[model samples]
Target: MPDLPDISNIPYLPSPARDMNWRDLNRFKSSDRGSDFYKTCLDYSQVLWRQRLPARAILCLDRAWGADLTGDEPILESWPLPYQALVYILQNAPTGVFLGNPRIHFQHYADRLGEPRLEQRKWRSWACWALSCKARPDFQSDPDHDVEEPSLEKIAQKLDQYGHIEETKLWKSILQAID
Candidate 1:
């Protein structure tokens, strides 16, 4: 048999399905929700891993958790709760979305998303991890700019690249909800 492609590196799978208990769901609903936001943040982190966006995926995860070490305000402030959760998990997340320069990644997320209160140690740790990933001179930056501000067209394009008919339909549904 032909050598199988390494499947281990793929990230961001199992798209998010809006299925959480009322309590878990309510956390993102309130402004003073506290750690609940972090929980939701982690959940989205898992989703990014399944989706295969990896680096950008982790950026989404981190943005959700409120790390935003970077200075970008509009991306952070304008982020909806779901998107924020997605970004937060993306930040410190391992397993998928590996990127270089955790500090730069954190700063990039901050630049994309407005700054928020974050645990200093956790944020720094993630930054370190990101930097380690960046140390590899061979790592090329992601070509997809739309990952930051994903539009229907971008979603459709990505779906066409990696998704099946059902997945494409599901992405359309997600786009409708976001719109």
Candidate 2:
């Protein structure tokens, strides 16, 4: 059998927070408990694109989105800034963009977390489409277009479908990513 490529070999940029001005880092550190801190983290995550960091960018973006959904703070600012930041990162990342084929990454993480097959399949599909769309030209030009606006009905349905399981956390994070 051919040996599978090691996922760990993928290169990621170091966290920009390490190199940021102490004031900025202090803001992030202080805001960590605030809802807006996650969005700030997302903003910092944008630095990865300019620095050619892919894996780390996605990981941080995911973390930021996770914090956003946990009622960290209302995304008070318009989506354009964060969206553009993400687009820029996706475009420049060394992994050829699209965050490493969302289907594969999502499934790999899901399996590692011991998620059920059905839930894993659902998330994989959702994540793949979300990540793939990030590479579209329209995504960059029209920051709002790629976002999958979740209606109350959709959110409620998701809550109903996966809320009881630990996967709910993952689903919530996915919803944030899609937003």
Which predicted model would earn the best TM-score?
A: 2
Q: What is the lDDT of residue 8 in candidate 1?
A: 35
Model 2 regions lying over 4 Å from their true place: 1-33, 68-72, 80-88, 91-102, 110-130, 133-179
The C-alpha TM-scores of every prediction are: 0.34, 0.42
Cα displacement (angstroms), candidate 2, residue 174, comes to 13
Q: Tell me, by lDDT, which candidate is best.
A: 2
Where does candidate 1 stray beyond 4 Å? 1-30, 64-104, 107-115, 118-130, 133-179
Report every candidate's CA lDDT: 0.40, 0.42
lDDT of 2 at 89: 50
lDDT of 1 by residue, 1-179 (tens): 54433333222223346643335434455455344354455455554454444565555454344532232333323332233223233333444335544444543452344223433323332332333333332434344533343334544555455333343454344333431
